[model samples]
Target: MLHALAEQNTPEVRKQARRYAEQRIPLLRGACVPVSKQTPRDLVDDAITDIFLGDGDPWDPNQCDLLTHLRGAILKRTWLEIRHRKLVRYSPFDLAEGDVETVLARERPHASRGDISPIVFASMIELVATELRKIETRDGPAQVILECWQVGFVERREVMLLTGLDDETYKLARERILLRKKYLPPRLVAIVEDLLDRSA
Candidate 1:
């Protein structure tokens, strides 16, 4: 089966790869416990796609069998899904954890500006820009977020679209901002807190 998956590159081999993945659906489901219900299914699909696309090196004949390899793939992908969930708090552009309606109302274009005095708002923006520059190494999401902000993208949805980031990259960037937000000056943090308090 490993040989077929690695060498043949034929429909029969692809079919066999999917068959093996199907056999491990239960294992995948068990591994994805506490994750979204669709995660296991997505992992299986990813594994199958990997097999069909020949994305990874062929399974070493001496290292493992088809079942073992498929299970490992399932487990690996499941872990990534779990980690992503841990990092990501809400859907793109949604407010962090809090009163959803209130946050949304505050985040509205006009309302957000009205919520803060001009001087404080300018200070907050300057603080964020200065602090972001002081960070020697920024993660992908952080960089993307900074770029979006520099470009005057206040809306998450617009930032996402303009940045052309996939779901994982976007989530990662957002997570970095939340985690790194603490490093910002106290006043900046307070302003950010008032805006959106989702932590990494």
Candidate 2:
């Protein structure tokens, strides 16, 4: 089909072909975290490496290369970079921090479009909610909230995946999210906690 599109020189068809190409295993792995913690996101990242590059070491900068690294098994295709000394928007690593203030302090900038639709936000919230379940069952409710505040609203992966951004678009969108912390305040995490409690 892609060959047919290229041979026919249909720009519209080529665009769809690009979408098809992007939807391969890497993107799918890039989209979702595993349903298990013993699973680890780095293993997923390494699996993405194995799938895309046929090697397993995503954490090694010298041995493996990609545009970004998710920093472990849970974050196969996601990663973070310092937008500035004052800001960082790497979702996977952002959540990896041990302190809630550290995670919450790393706020995403605001864009008019960052106001994600309720259905989409609900879905992302559910994802977080599910992860929270694992954490809470293993730890305790306060620990869960602490973890929530740590990586709360500045979750770049949720924003990035929902937007399905290309590299340039991701740059613009992430930078905008970093600059507009007021729009992406850490407080929104509290709402997620309430949701979890209600469900419990």
What stretches of model 1 exceed 4 Å from their correct place? 1-122, 135-138, 187-200
- Reference-based TM-score, model 2: 0.23
lDDT of 2 by residue, 65-130 (tens): 222232232232233211131133134322353443333334322212212222323344444444
Full-model lDDT, candidate 2 = 0.35
lDDT of 1 by residue, 68-181 (tens): 555567655654654464355333443356542334335434433214323343344455567676544636667767778666574556778888887778777776666655
Best by TM-score: 1
* lDDT of every predicted structure (CA atoms): 0.52, 0.35
